[model samples]
Target: MILVIGGTGTTGRIVAAKLAERGHPTRIASRHPSTEGVRFDWYDPTTHPDALRDVRAIYAIPPVGEVDPAPIMLPFLERARSAGVRRVVLLSSSAIGPAGHGLGMVHARLGELFVQWAVLRPSWFMENFVGEQPHAVSAREQGEIVSATGTARVGFVDPADIAEVAVRALTDPTPHNTDHLITGPEALSYDEIAAVLSEVSGRPVKHRAIDPVGLAARHTANGIPPDFARFLASLDTAIAAGAEDRTTSTVADVTGRTPRTFRDFCRDRLRGDRPG
Candidate 1:
């Protein structure tokens, strides 16, 4: 059976559903036990065994917002390995590299721990702008999207595309055994995204750029933990420096299908005169 960590989350649920659709024996790991998921929590090691029971492979979404997730993740991974789990698919971020900090540590460890593994480093999610997320809420209620990215462009990707590739990595006969830097079809600036939102919703939407310090302060005021809020703000500077101004064919190369575009995402999610 394939154990899907964080199975109730954005990409995890999609991954679990896809695995089931393909007739794979899928076990969903959640803090809340349900018919669809098994009880699991990263902070609680006692919950690991039940989730790892008879599992062959794993799709790991490590502890969120951890600048250093190695401590928690490495232990659990070792436990999974001891429990006979073989292949592992890690959901990493494009912002974090194998040689970089934070999840990068876990990224490096996965390769050493399991020969059959794939690391998915996907670009920023398009869903960040179409749901109840801060960006979306601000766009709807305040008529603008706030960021510290300045005028830099990012290869904003769809979660479904990421999930498709995750499914492939988990179930394929031959392990990918490498990291996939996944992205959408094109790169776009937050300014251009605002323009698209304006056209789709027929509203005067705009991107409100600010310094990382200011953004961090705002995020903290909005109830995010101060340290994590600062970390989130810091990542925007990487974008402003042109770190994400590129796209790749990893999606099509892995799934043998074209990944969806931002415009396509806007059309499908943002509708009914809403700013979604």
Candidate 2:
């Protein structure tokens, strides 16, 4: 059985669904399951064993909003190894590296912990513009998207593409003991993205750039922890410094199809469902 951690999340749900579609006996693990799944919590170690039962491969998503997930994840991973889990596909981010903070620490040690391992360092998600995140909320309510990334470009990929790659990593016969840098076809600036959003939805959307400190403060006001907010702000600051100004073909190479653009993603979402 393939175990999908964070199975109800943005990418995890798609990964679980794709695994099932491919005839894999998939097990969904969540902190609060809405369906027939195991209750798995990162802070609760006792739940680990039951979730790992009969599971051979795992699609691992580190605890959300965590600054450092390696310490919490390592013990569970060790137990997974002891429980006979062989393959592990960890979802990481392009901004963080093997030696960087957060899930990067998990990426640093993923290879030696399992027989088959892959670290997916996907770029920013386009879903952020339509989901419950601050970007989406602001766009829907205020007709603007705020960020610290001033005039910077990003290759925002769809979560479905990321999920497809995750499925391949989990089920592929060979151990792809390497990191995959996933991204969409083109890099686009926030201003460009806002213009596209305006065109697609026929709304007057705009990009509002602010300082990193201000962005962090806004995130904190939205109930995000101070440190996590600062971390997110730092990512935006990095983007402003041209950190995410490139694109990659990983999605097409892995999935045999071109990754969707921001316009396509927006068009699909706005076709029937109006933004709240």
Q: Estimate the TM-score of every prediction.
A: 0.97, 0.97
Q: In candidate 1, what are the lDDT values of residues 133-214, reduced to their tens digit?
A: 8888898889999999999999999999999999999999999999999999999999999998888876788999999999
Question: Using alpha carbons, what is the TM-score of model 2?
Answer: 0.97
Segments in model 2 whose C-alpha atoms lie over 4 Å from true places:
274-276
**Tens-digit per-residue lDDT, 69-113, candidate 2:** 888999999999999999999999999889845587789888888
lDDT scores in order: 0.92, 0.91
RMSD, one per candidate, in order: 1.5, 1.4
Q: Give model 2 RMSD, 1 decimal.
A: 1.4
**Top model by TM-score, which number?**
2
Off by over 4 Å in 1: 273-276
